[model samples]
Target chain A: MLQQLSAQELPKVEQEMTDFITQYTTQEDLKKSMLYSIEAGGKRIRPLIVLATVQAFQKTLNAPVYQTAGALEMIHTYSLIHDDLPAMDDDDLRRGKPTNHKVFGEALAILAGDGLLTGAFQLISETTLEPTENVLLIQLLAKAAGIGGMVAGQAGDMAAEHQQVSLGELKAIHRGKTGALLTYAFVAGGILAQQPAYVLTLLEKLGGHIGLAFQIRDDLLDVVGTTEALGKQVGQDEKSAKSTYPALLSVAGAKDALEQELAQAQATIEQLTKAAGFQPQVFQELLALFTL
Target chain B: MLQQLSAQELPKVEQEMTDFITQYTTQEDLKKSMLYSIEAGGKRIRPLIVLATVQAFQKTLNAPVYQTAGALEMIHTYSLIHDDLPAMDDDDLRRGKPTNHKVFGEALAILAGDGLLTGAFQLISETTLEPTENVLLIQLLAKAAGIGGMVAGQAGDMAAEHQQVSLGELKAIHRGKTGALLTYAFVAGGILAQQPAYVLTLLEKLGGHIGLAFQIRDDLLDVVGTTEALGKQVGQDEKSAKSTYPALLSVAGAKDALEQELAQAQATIEQLTKAAGFQPQVFQELLALFTL
Candidate 1:
């Protein structure tokens, strides 16, 4: 199910992203650095999630949906670019390619990330959505990706490096660092679809659970997955003494947590589907993507 | 005239900025770093420009105007934070205080800048404006602050470091780096006031000339101003081999250029006042702030 959706939607998302990015025709090198990181492919999972959630709501996918999805991807990509900076994670490799700073120097890399981030806001704000909807979407995206969300998580994660942290601390870090934007992706779809308050609430819950499950899976993958499979270095968290779910909870425990979160996510989606009286098969299929 | 406006409006801008920034009630450390940079005051020039432009149109100041002003200041502060990173300008002092990275670690400083940039969008998008207006403001702000505007200029400026750049290249850099946002400030005020196209066009022109004049004056200040007076190290641009206007054009030539730009800016404002049929005494007063 995810494959079919990705095959259909990923190309469109890429096209929209490309079109939006190319609008800045000046600053060839800066544009190149931005395009390089963005064009470097990933699962495009966040955007797919957005499309799926909108589809689940029986809303016809439109420009606003695609642009919002593209914007989220841009934000995600920008964070990754900055995260890979020498002052941060200092990784030289991402997606089996040299990190942004490696290809373009640190200054350009930072600016490229800034460019993408600011561009994301531009894309969303300029979307054809109603003013109230645009406001809601921007508010959600900002809070999720801004200080209260991803940035805070990053700060905490960096601060906790080489230090022992409680399981609670690990959960908080994971929620903000990885969960906020992911959750926003799901909730933003709901916003675009004009989902009712109850439906939106359920979607947020579902997003939270999926976010935890996705992050735990990532921690597990880092521990057990090979560099070839992960497309980046493995065991990085351990090497840097950064706390991870698998580290805080043993591997078996982490797997259990992932299972629990996935189950919770499924339950919430079921509730949402029944309450909203819509088919959520696509959502279910998307959820399955998180499973081992 | 500048003093009277600052005395009345500067405090209000500061208060609004403080109120808006303190809304991030979580991640205490991250919030502190953000507030630290924000509270370490400059002249509040950008926000003041925004406010002054709005007043020039005789619009009763409202929440949206103050919020937009605050947002621009946040963007400016964020850019300074990022520009001062060791990878970029590498300055340790700003406004006679330790740069953000000096006080907060480089990681936190980067995150703080990100927070403020994101927060700026939140402040604007969440404003209680009509949807079309909000969209226009966001588009203008994003374009001015994004890749096509300030970020592009910064990239060009950085790329030109230690290299001999032509006069055309220098103007292009100044336009994006400095002119874009300044122009946006004027245009945004016109937007908020619902000024006609002719007025907005004039404001854009006014902003462009002022932005050029402001930058040239900065270059001159670097060449001649004292550290105690300027609140930053002088001659640092020369020390770093940055291609300033005075470097490419002789000091006298740079001053001549500044005068030309200022005169053009005054003419544009004069035309705007006549066309829009409003007293632009406040705007003329504001322009005086840029003079040596």
Candidate 2:
């Protein structure tokens, strides 16, 4: 179910994101630079999760949903662009392509990332959702993607570099870095679907588990997966002397942790089903993607 | 009157911006970096405009108005932070103080700016304004600060460096880079004061003129002002071979242009007073700030 929905809706997410850049940005270089990164490509998993969560609630997959999803992906893409800057992670490639800075130069790449980040809020603001909903969505997105969430997470991650961290501290870092927006995907889906606060709460928990699963899996993949499979250099995290789940938990223990998170996510989906009758099949399939 | 109001309300504006960072960011490093820029002194002209505009309408200077103003300042500050990066203007000083990157390191400086920008939207959403107002404000802000606005302008400005551009093209670049947010400050104030669309339209036009005046004055200042007065490098624009009003127009011609814009701004303010009974004193004093 998740596969079918993702395949069907992912293209629309890409289109919406591209259309946003083309329609709003008139400056030639700015437009081109923005489009370059937006088109550079990723799994669009954040948006896919949003679409799936909305679908699980049996809500109409409206334009607002897609715009919301696209906004999520833009924020994710912008983060990747900035993270790859020479000042930060300094990676030359992302998803096997030249990083944004590598192609656009550092100045324009920084602006492109800034543009995308601000553009995400614009996209959310332009959503066909009710005014109240738009307000909520903007608030949620800013917090999730900004200092309190992803930015802070990145800062923490960098601050902890070349230093061993407690497992709990590591989880906190990933929760802000990756988990915030991933959690937002589900919760925002619930918001758009008009699920009650309690249902949104349950969605938050589910998203949290999923977020943890995602980071652990990413850590595992970096340690054990190949550059070919990952589409970026492998073992870069360990090479940076950065802490990771696999390093802290060991490969086997990290795998156990991943399974636990997946299981918790599955159990939460069941609880959501009981509470709001949200379809669990899509969520279950989503859990499968995180599994090694 | 503008000075009095600015003096009285600017502290509150600073307080709100500071409160926002403190309340939202839990990560100490992120919070410190964000605050470093926010507290780094500037004229706070943008927020002061918002305050004066509300006051001009005989509207209560509400909390929402301050939040909106603070958001504008955040967007402006973020742009400054990013602009001062080694990859951009490579400036080491602003307001006679070390740049954010100089103190915080390049990576943290970048994240801090990102946090402030994203935090701006969060500040807007939390404002007590009507939900519809919040939506419109967010939409306007995202457009002004994002690709279509400041980012695009920055791109155009950088692209045009060492290359001469016509007056019209130069204006377009400055319009996005500085005009957008400066204009936003006025228009958003009108929105908060619940001015009619025509009044808001007039404010937009007024903002346009003020933006032009502001840029012209900046160009003029770079040519003739001292470092003590400017609080940064003087004559850097000419040093970079960047196009400026003084470069295209003679110094006398640039000053002439500045006077023309300030005159147009006064006319628009008068028109607003006629149409909406908004007081003209605040705006007239605002224009005085651009004078040599």
Give the i-RMS of model 2 in Å: 0.7
For model 1 chain B, give the 10-residue run with minimal summed lDDT.
B1-10
DockQ of each: 0.74, 0.90
lDDT, candidate 2, equals: 0.91
Candidate 1 accuracy as TM-score = 0.96
Give the 10-residue window scoring lowest on summed lDDT in candidate 1 chain A: A272-281
lDDT of 2 at B178: 92
Residue B147 of model 2, lDDT score: 84
Deviation of model 2 at B93, angstroms: 0.6
- Cα error, residue A19 of model 2, in Å, equals 0.6
lDDT, model 1, position A126? 80
Model 1 Cα shift for residue A250 (angstroms): 1.9
Predictions in order: lDDT: 0.87, 0.91
Model 2 DockQ reads 0.90
- Candidate whose DockQ is highest: 2
